[model samples]
Every structure is written in structure tokens, then in C-alpha cells.
Target: MIIRPALATELPALRTLETAAGAPFHDVGMASVAEDEPPALPVLAASLRAGRLLVAYEEGGPDGGLAGYLMWEPVDGATHIEQVSVAPAYAHRRIGQALIDRAGADGGDRPLTLTTFREVPWNAPYYARLGFRPLTDAELTPGLRAIRAHEAELGLDRWPRLCMRREAAG
Candidate 1:
């Protein structure tokens, strides 16, 4: 898989890949999550414009189709990972990990942070395996707190979730 900044023309493909990636949530008893729409085109376009949207493409696979994607932004001195999704067909292939690692490299000295479902096997647990640790309430930065608040307002708090952080690779 090749990981690189997303092209403007490929934004729609990332949406499709994200929807496919979300399908597994249904089997995990979170149909609402599975059915949630991918980020809107304008939101994705903004990320792309910021150079924070990265896509993983399967080399030589059907016009080099997208296999996964990750979007992030700077928040409170950290690189806040907003989303990372790999198509089920590409699961366990390390595409998500590679994307995250790339983001860490790009983030330089900043720590990597994200909010995820605490119970989902591929959420907090998966991130733990990747070196992320759950943050205590006292550890939450103002920006992270706001992000969590927004998530709660969106009804994502129906399932347990928490913020996690991984120290910078540097």
C-alpha cells in the first residue's frame, strides 16, 4: 500500500472507503456507527487543502484504489487524529498503522492524540496496541475537551469513548 496526501479528485473515493470501513461496526452492535455518513465533501476538501488528509492506495489494484485514509489536525500542541479508517477487505494489513505512523512523522515534535470508542476491539484496544494510552480527565487539553464535548453533543457518547495519546516518535 502507498500512503500519501489525498488528491482533490479522490475525495469521493475516500468517503466510499470510509463507509466500507464503518460496516464492521454493525457486526459489533453499533449500527448507528455503521450507518453514519462519512465526512462531507466540504469537510474533506478542507482537510485536503490543509494537507492533513492522507489516503492509502493499493498499488496496482484496480487503478490504485484507496484502501484506507486518515485525517487529522493540530489542536492544543498535538496532532489530533480525527479519523482513520481502513476498508474491511484491507483490515489487518497495517494500512491504518502505517497511516498513523506517517502522521506521527509528519507531526514532528507534537504528540498524537485521538478520541475513540473505548470498548470496540478496533478502537481503544487497537490503539493501545499501537502505543496509545487513555487520557485521564486531568490530562485532557482544552481543545480535546471541546472535541469530546462536540462528540457528545452528536450522540456519540451513547457508547463509551475516551481520548488517547501517543508520544511523538521524535
Candidate 2:
């Protein structure tokens, strides 16, 4: 797989890809999540414009299409993982991990932080396997606290959630 910055023209396709990626949630009793729309076009465009988005394209196999995408934002002292998704057909092939690895590389030596579903196999558990650890409430920075508040306002707190952090690679 080859990973590179997302192009402006690729934003719409990324949203479509993200919707396809959300489909698996329906099978896991989280159809609401699957139904949620991808972030608005302007939000995606802004992230792309800020050079905060990256996409992984297949280097081999049919057509070498987009495998997945990841986004991050500098929040507090860390690079906050805003989103990461792999189209179902391309999942389980470490595309998500590769996107994350790219983010880590571009993160400027700051820890990577994110919030995720606490019980979902592909959410918090997947991240834990990648070296993230659940952060205690006491460890939540002001930016993270605001992030959680925003999530709560969005009703994402309906399900169990947790903040997690991965240290900068040595």
C-alpha cells in the first residue's frame, strides 16, 4: 500500500468510501452509527486544505483503489485522531494501521490521541492493540474535555466511549 496526502479532488470519494466503511457497524447492532452521515463536505474539505488528511491507495491487486483514509488535528499537545476508516472490502489488511502509522510519522513527535467506542472490537480494542491506552479522566486535557463535550452533544455518548492515547514513537 502507498500512503500520501489526500487531494482536494478526492474528498467526495472519501466521503463515499467512509459511508461504505460505516456499513459494518450495522451488523454489529450499531445501525445508528452506520446511518450517520460522513462529516460534512466543508469539514472534509477544510481538513484536506489543512493538510490533515491522508489516504492509502492499493499498490497492487485490482485497480489499486483507495484503501482507507485518516484525519487528525492538533489539539492540546497531541495529534488528535479525528477519523480513520477502511472500506470493508479492504479492511483487515492493515490499511487503517498504515494510515495511523503515517499520522504518527507526521505528528511532530507528539502523542496521538483519540476517542472511541469502548466495547467495539474494531474501536477501542483495535487501538489498544496498536499501543494506545485508555486515559483516565484526570488525564484528559482541556482540548480533550471539549472534544468529549462535543461528542456528548452529538449523542455519541449514548454508547460507551473512552479517551485513549498512544505515546510518540521513540
Candidate 3:
């Protein structure tokens, strides 16, 4: 698999990949999440233009060969991962991790941060294995607090969630 900045023409394919990735939420009893719409095309396009959308591609496959994708942005001096999704067919592979690592590498010395379901197997626990540590409410930076608040407005607070941070790899 090769990872690179997403191209403008690949935006729609990434949305499809996100839908496929969200399907697993059904098995985890988060059917609402499974049925939730992928990010709007304009939102994704903006991320792509900002150089924060990275995609994993199979070398010789069709349909832009998207295997997975990650979107992030600089927030409060850290690289805040807004979303990361790997197609079900590519599950268990390290594509997600690779995309995150690439984001960190691109972010220089800033730490990497994200908000995710606290108990989901592939959410907080998976991030923990990747060296992220959960932050208490008091530990949340202003930007992170704002992000969490927005998530609450979107009903993501229906499930337990928290912010996590991983220091830049030395």
C-alpha cells in the first residue's frame, strides 16, 4: 500500500471509503453511527486543499485504489486528528496507523490528538496501544474542549467519549 496526499478527483471515492468504514459500527451496536452521513464533499475538499487529507492506496487497484484515509488539522499547537477510516476490506492492516504516523511526521514537533469513543475496541483502546493517553476534562485544551462540545451537539455524546494525546515520536 502507498500513502499520499489525497487528490481533488479522489474526494468522492474517499467518501465512499468512509461509508464502508463506518459499517462496522453496526456490529458494535452503534447503528446510528453506522448510518451517519460521511463528511460533506466540500469539507473533505477543504481538508485536501489544506494538505491534511491522506489516503492509502493499493498500487494497482481501480477506483482511485483507496484503501483508507485520515483527516487532521493543526489545533492548539497539536495535530488534531478529525477522522480516520479504513475500509472494512483493509481492516487489521496498519493502514490507519500509517496514516496517523504520516500526519505526525508532517506535523513536526506537535503532538497528535483526537477525540473518540472511550470503550470502543477500535477506538480508545486501539489508540492506547498506539501510545496515546486519555486526558481528563481538566486536561483538555480550549480547542479540544470546543471540538468535544461540537461533538456533543451532534449527538456523539450519546456514547462515552474522551480526548487522547500522543506525543510526537522522538
User: Pick by TM-score: which candidate is best?
Assistant: 1
lDDT tens digits, residues 66-126, model 2? 8899989999989999999998878799999989988999988999999999998999999
Clashing pairs in 2: none
lDDT of 1 by residue, 40-148 (tens): 9999999999999998888766536578899999999999999999987778989899999999998889999999999999999999999999999999999999999
| Candidate 3, residue 27: how far the Cα is off, in Å | 1.0
Ten contiguous residues minimizing lDDT sum, candidate 1: 58-67
For each candidate in turn, the TM-score is 0.97, 0.96, 0.96
Per-residue C-alpha lDDT of model 3 across residues 120-140, encoded as one tens digit per residue = 999999999999999998899
What is the lDDT for 89 in model 2? 76
C-alpha positional error of residue 40 in candidate 1 after TM-score superposition, expressed in Å: 0.2
TM-score of 1: 0.97
- Those runs of model 2 whose alpha carbons end farther than 4 Å from true positions after fitting are 60-64
Model 2 residue 29 lDDT score: 87
Q: Which has the higher lDDT value, candidate number 1 or candidate number 2?
A: 1
